[model samples]
Target: MQLAANKGFATEKVLNLHEISHSLEFYANGRLVRNDDGRQRKFQGVSEVIEFVKRNGGERVLVVLPLDRVSEMNVDSIEPTFIADNGALALYAVRVR
Candidate 1:
């Protein structure tokens, strides 16, 4: 959240179905989005939000998660287009085709 904020990405408060069921902070604009909290839930919350947003006309979403969660989360189902390692953070980009 701080990194994106420092980079000038605006904070978007998401209060909807997915947020109620699973707490996942998301920030985005144009083709990229970043996940703020990735400690308690792992990929379930983030993936759910991504799917919901994509269905509602989103594309090229990038979810930023903790580095340790790389092996824990189920990436096979979500199938991110690309994964980038950034020291303590891991970014999963979902590019809709």
Candidate 2:
């Protein structure tokens, strides 16, 4: 979430979907389900992230921290945020074409 970090959405403590219990992860009948609590915690979860997509409606989520933060998770399409875009160390966070 390098873009999110650049945009000031980064958290001091970060966790991904694989790290949490499946129950905490939201899945909608083989699809992604949403969870409101994801955005508020130090660690972000799949269900919570799914919830963000619902409320935000695919607006644009930026990555500004580390690629590994999301590498193991399931997601597609991310718009680059300015700060992360400007950072030279952000190449790892960019989606490979």
lDDT agreement with native, every candidate: 0.44, 0.34
Instruction: Give the Cα-based TM-score of candidate 1 against the true structure.
Output: 0.42
Segments in model 2 whose C-alpha atoms lie over 4 Å from true places? 1-43, 64-67, 75-97
Best by lDDT: 1
Per residue, candidate 1 scores C-alpha lDDT tens digits across 18-94 of 11222233333223323466322233565575665567676444455566655534545555533444576554544
lDDT tens digits by residue: candidate 2, 28-69: 122222246633232254445445544554433322223455
Q: How many backbone clashes does candidate 1 have?
A: 0
Question: Which candidate number has the best TM-score?
Answer: 1
Q: How displaced is residue 41 in candidate 2, in Å? A: 5.3
lDDT against true structure, model 1: 0.44
